[model samples]
Target: MTRVLVPLLRASCPPGAGGYGGSIELRLPDSEAERLGGVALVRAALRAAARELGWKAETFGWTGTIHGTMVGVTDRRTPPAPFDSVVDADRQRRMRDAVDRVGRPGTPSLPPTDEPSARLPTEEFLTAYAAAQGVVDR
Candidate 1:
């Protein structure tokens, strides 16, 4: 299994107009990332998670393979929160700096992952992905 690296913010036109960016970023633990094998499972689980919230997942930049990760866009059905996009540019810069100082990317890899399928088994992958989203599989 492998950890997924998804972009923090990549909202579509509607979500952007709703001021849905520059929010606090949450880092998923390595243990959690490992459970999801690659981007497909992560995207699937995220889509499932968002569906519960009445939002649809529209992904952009899916390279298909683990190496080609993509960002999932969400429906902006809900009104913008007061805190939405409350973060200032300076603070955002500082956040980036902090991440650069302490944050690390997933284990570096090549065109293809070590695994034959280039991903983990679906069950294991979804389990971890769901857990990361705090979505207990039903």
Candidate 2:
């Protein structure tokens, strides 16, 4: 399992205006993130943490859009498996083709299309994501 440390960005409260808040470190399962469900699970954890801490956090940067106004953490390591697995080879190829076409240099292309779908996690992925988040899976 890979671990990610996300840093929280604090909003400036006027000088000397103190508040009971600080950055937090979130450790997430590296394996799950490659899969769609993994992303959703991690996002949920971040949201819960923010709510409990009374802070508005936005997950941005390497970790992707996890939520609104929350801190996101990521280690530069990409795990193997599902991320490299070709469950839908044809679809994956098509997606790549589309990206290549649009990414052509000097070519003004349309924005990428959003494919709404659910992520199905492998048992291993689920287990790892849960453990990393410290959630008790009963």
Candidate 3:
């Protein structure tokens, strides 16, 4: 099964704002970028634009078990929030202990609760994309 990067905005934007050559910058995590390559990231943005216009995903020239990697597109107006953690509890605790050992007081070892993350699993992403594109209602 071919895998494709799926780029999505961290926040909703008004229509036409995310249009082509409009300075919208998309980004994947360092690990993902290393895994997927830069070309795949660009392709994801193109696919996103096409998909946003109601085009079929098949028309994008690849078909298989699509494993979508969630990425964020920077709108340039605001800096993005910290990334969500996929680490296990043990790892998180170890990290916190490491931080504590370093004497970094008041440093948060977990993701902030102020703003929610936009990153979603493939299934949830598809649903959200459909809803955002007006293909379905929540």
Off by over 4 Å in 1: 1-35, 61-68, 78-138
Backbone clash numbers for all candidates listed: 0, 5, 0
Candidate 1: tens digits of C-alpha lDDT, residues 36-131: 454455556555544444454454424433443443445444345543444234346555655555555873333432532213233334465466
- Residues 84-122 of candidate 3: C-alpha lDDT, one tens digit per residue: 121133235545655655556576454344432233333
Instruction: Rank the candidate models, highest TM-score first.
Output: 1, 2, 3
Report residue 54 deviation for candidate 1 (angstroms). Answer: 1.0
Off by over 4 Å in 3: 1-11, 14-42, 46-70, 77-106, 110-114, 120-124, 129-138
lDDT string, candidate 2, 1-138, tens digits: 223212121221112223222233333335435443455555655555444444555544234435222224222222235432332343355567667657868877666456421121223334555677787871
Whole-model alpha-carbon lDDT for candidate 1: 0.40
Off by over 4 Å in 2: 1-21, 25-30, 34-36, 61-138
TM-score of 3: 0.26
Total residue pair clashes for candidate 2: 5
Reference-based lDDT, each prediction: 0.40, 0.39, 0.37
Q: Report the poorest 10 consecutive residues by lDDT, candidate 3.
A: 78-87
Q: What is the lDDT of residue 5 in candidate 2?
A: 18
Q: What TM-score does model 2 achieve against the real structure?
A: 0.27
Give the winner by lDDT. 1
lDDT score, candidate 1, position 44: 61
